[model samples]
Target chain A: MSPLSLTHRDTVAGPVLLVAGELDFVHAAELRRQVEGLVLHAGQCLVLDLSGVEFCDSTGITALLAARQHALAAEAEIVLAAVPAHLERILTIVGLVQVFTLRATAEDT
Target chain B: MGCARRVPADLNASPGPTTGPGLRSAPGAGDAGAPVGETWRHAPYPVLVADRRGVLTGLNEAARQYLPRAARGDRLRDLAPSWLAEAHHRLAEARSPGGGDVPAGHLGDRFFEAHPTPAGDGRVVWWLIDRTDALQAETALHSARTRSEMLSGIASTLLSTLNVPRCMEVTASLAAQHLAEGAVLIAPPQGRRHQLTYAARGTGAVQVTQQVDTRSVPGLAEALQGFPPVPARWLNPDDIPDWLIPEGFTGPVGSVIVTPLPGHGVPAGALVLLRSGTEKAFTEGEEAFARLFAARAGAALSAARLYAEQSAITATLMRELLPPKLGSVHGVEYAGNYRAATDQERIGGDFYDVHPGSDPSRETLVVLGDVAGKGLDAAVLTGKIRNTLQALLPLADDHQRVLSLLNGALLSSHQTRFATLVLASVRRGDEGVHLRLTSGGHLPPLIIRADGTVEEAPTHGTLVGALPQVRARTIETVLAPGEICLLYTDGITEARGGPLGEELFGEERLRRALAGCAGMPAEAVVEHVQMLAFQWLRSGGHDDMAVVAIGAARSGGPPTVAGAKDGMNL
Candidate 1:
């Protein structure tokens, strides 16, 4: 179980939050807090880069949804970039692919 | 003559004018006439007339009685030595006609205020008024305020922690810091003769628990009788109780205040505060403050004790509710695992039992069940169902009869609660191994064949405990070798999670996962499925899950038990 690491960079669209490692119960809250602390402007898009996430649990999924809700409440947009295959399968199974905008990579965003 | 007159020894007893004929009237003294002089002679307060050079010119009777040796021509500083210097300064200022009265001062133990006025001939008349009672009242009020503040501090500090031992430590340390030098808090003995004691010396607190017969401590037993605080003045070492003295304590304790900590209607413990050095016996005000603090500590201790006791009971009950370890059964590999929802206590409605057959057939009976709800209520129902099934083990050959009987028992005793269960009877013969499975509205058992094919055994029935009678069906199958049958509760298939948490890991996914476990052992099959479902839920927030796997040993030389090869994976 690799420890979760978070990094961020500013872009013209908004800020890109890069998440890596396992996103289970113990580490999900950390990501949630980090995403919630982001300052976004209306019409801006927040990109969540999950290319490095090796595993994700239900708590991690809930955290991502919470980020989407936060973005919606702020009248902004949120996108998932570089989702892994297993996680993408889960997202498709739960029918959340339509809720979040997905991109192949951060460069695409 | 310039000789000063001495005051009479019985001045208070005489109650008469103090003026004597030894003095001659000065020129222009008639301006302040004899009538005014007579008024000054009998005044209640001390009155004195002084010249510019600090010489006393006249004195009143009250002044003579208070000072005992004051007369004309005596320096005013010689009498009332503490206040005369300040009075002289005030008198000089008074001569300017706009100066205010002098501030109050003390003479011996008596407090006094002075009023100086020009006497029309360069002399100043000083009147002294006592203010002892007002000062004492202020001092008392200040002490009371300090005591109440200390009480609030101790209350907040002790009540902040719910941990029993930590609360004791805080109580002792706070008492020492605010109220006394040495503090001791003794909790009532729980079950034994030993009492929990926390003692503080200076700022450091130490726990010194000692078991002592309650009869040995005289005043302590009485203090524990739930009375108001008992104060004791210890004049000597013998005055201290033999049993109450803490080890390594060697200082002179002047007084002890012992108060009962009454909790809810009973006594929780006793708090003992010891004042050392020159501190006097516990005053009324201090005792009241101690009682207030003890009330708060008592309530907190009572609550903490109750919480500790409840936790212990819950732990014991959980241990009993947990499924027993599955023992090795001949000719079959068996493994079982149970995991409750993350938010619930470890005890849940999910339960599994393996009862070996005692009849001629040598069949082993296995039961997996899930009650309708969770928590203690559901756990109790699960226990009843398991016990009833165990009693019906003799009917293992007839699955319908056993389940039908269980349904009747549930309908008669617990009509509101319902359960879903699966019963499996496994036996060995020359042919190979035989299995008769019965499902009481439970998910059908999945059989993973040696050829890596997964099939659901044909078993269906009505849910038990819901109706007067259950129409259960028994399905029979044979495992040649290296085949496993998995029984699980709905917690596996109905687990909700994934992207939007709207997805369920239904029977399709379960069948697919089982297809991969063709030659795997029983324990491995159970572990794989359990892990997969856990990963599907992600947060592990699904309902209680219980799985039991029974696999026929693959035929080679000899068959190996499932957990024997690799220990239980549960």
Candidate 2:
């Protein structure tokens, strides 16, 4: 039920976006817009720190995939840092556990 | 009717009491206090005595004060108001009083009705009585009547329809013909564009939509935003933008009024009225009346807008949310039922469709799914998913490939939604019936045997549309006569109800219900399952629940099973 908030921070891993709150139908497009607006050079890594994701639905899953697609099109690497436990189970249920690079924490990226 | 040229007797009657004869040089030698003819000299009302030649002979003290220019021997034309002098000439020539309106005119700032009485020596005594207050009262009464009639007409005409465009048209026309020489109605801007309905006196309104700079007109942008309008006097007529002028209107604007149309809670729109330079400038009273009119129009327009919006949503619901009817396919009986989450929530994420194959030999495809979210958005996506599945019927035998293709289609589209789907391909032959069931993150279908036991198919996969790939395992099973295979969405098991109104109608309850319906017909099986789930949630919680049962009709001969059931929940 929490509203979504996104914050961008430049890190050694390149650009890291801290995403908090529910990533459902209403807020998924906002997340996609934020990701698409980022300038990712080749070989740079874009990390999504989802440590605060409260609720993730199928639309939220699609948004994550769209972000990954955007990064790949820029020839940049994408990673999910600090994935919430429920979101991890969701990713596994959709057979997407092996698709993206995962890190234990944003600092690990 | 009285002759127009006749002067009525009342016009001849002296406006005041005639000089009392008793006062004229003592009627009985000692009864009078004034001398002979002194009453004419001291009449209380203005009295002018003019001869047939239109030359003033004498005047009373009141006349001197009322007509300051009058001299003892001056001509009536040079001393008195022209209307009075003209009346004196006309009345002096007539011997008897005629029948017609009396002459009236303005003398300085005061209004008067002049009465005449015959005097000796071919002269007329003119009495001027002030009637300024009476005339003003009558005029005000007439203007008030006219305004009330117009307001009532506006009310009836505005309430006549719920069509927004028609209402706007009427608003523009009424304001143009009644309130001003021309009118321009600006609807609330949608995005950066504005819709304008323009009307001129004696012309039908025309509508145009374009991006307009609201700031071009003074007080326009604020008025459009529901702010109170600035006084019309503050507006400079020359500053009006070209777009503001009604088409074909070829007159200079004398005055302009921009006012907000107050609606329910929010402003409906803004109204602009234009007056030609030849016409009188708008008055403060007129501006206040315009606001009253704008209020009525605003209420009606907003109501119409709301009605339009609601109907559009309903149309979408009717076209896409209603589940399709299921019937017998080939030799198998197919029946399905759907229920929305609540009365207000007529549509939710749950949806299902059964597509009969091109031929009797080909398997009929049944797809059931639940999209993310609920209501209108989810129902819309459900429609797309069903369409995609129908297009991939040729690949029904390969459930994994069908899901992957659908995934690609959904991902490529602009919708940010995904769905879980279970596809069932059915083929009937000399054997009872064959069904290949596949689950794409949807719960596996439950099979009912003639022996009254329920077995869950060993099939599961990732949901379609959201993931980069789809992986599913398809299980083949055969239904021996009078056996049913039930496919349903999560709404059935996820319904929160029972004692505390928080308990879920879980899978165990569903499996038990199916076992009780073993050996039943397809229609009966689905009805029984749905009825139980619906009853369990009678305490209140519900979601969009759907159940599709594909059953093989019982035969006269012994049943031949194509293969034994492969999966079991136990």
Fnat of each prediction, in sequence: 0.00, 0.40
Instruction: Name the regions of candidate 1 deviating beyond 4 angstroms.
Output: A1-109, B1-106, B110-142, B176-178, B183-186, B189-192, B196-200, B203-211, B227-239, B275-278, B325-335, B356-363, B427-434, B478-483, B517-542, B551-570
Given candidate 1, what's the lDDT at residue A37?
Answer: 97
Any runs in candidate 2 off by more than 4 Å, and if so which? A1-109, B1-317, B340-346, B414-416, B538-542, B555-570
Per-residue lDDT over B1-570 for candidate 1, one digit per residue giving the tens place of the 0 to 100 score: 011122223321233232221111332232433322445656577877787778888888777767777778888667766456555755565554233333457766676656554556677666665556655766788788887777777777777777888887787777666666667777787666545564545546677567766555446666676766566445464665656654444566677877888887878888777776566667777777778778888888887777788889888877778897774465577889998765557778889987765432467888998886667888888888988998888777888898889989998887436777899988765565689998886778999988888999888776677556667778899877788999998788867786666577877899999999999988899999999888899763677889999888775422344323442222
Worst 10 residues of 2 chain B by lDDT: B561-570
TM-score of each: 0.63, 0.51
User: Comparing to the true complex, what docking class would candidate 2 get?
Assistant: incorrect
Total clashing pairs for each candidate: 1, 1
- DockQ, candidate 2, comes to 0.20
Number of the top lDDT candidate? 2
Cα lDDT listed for each candidate: 0.73, 0.79
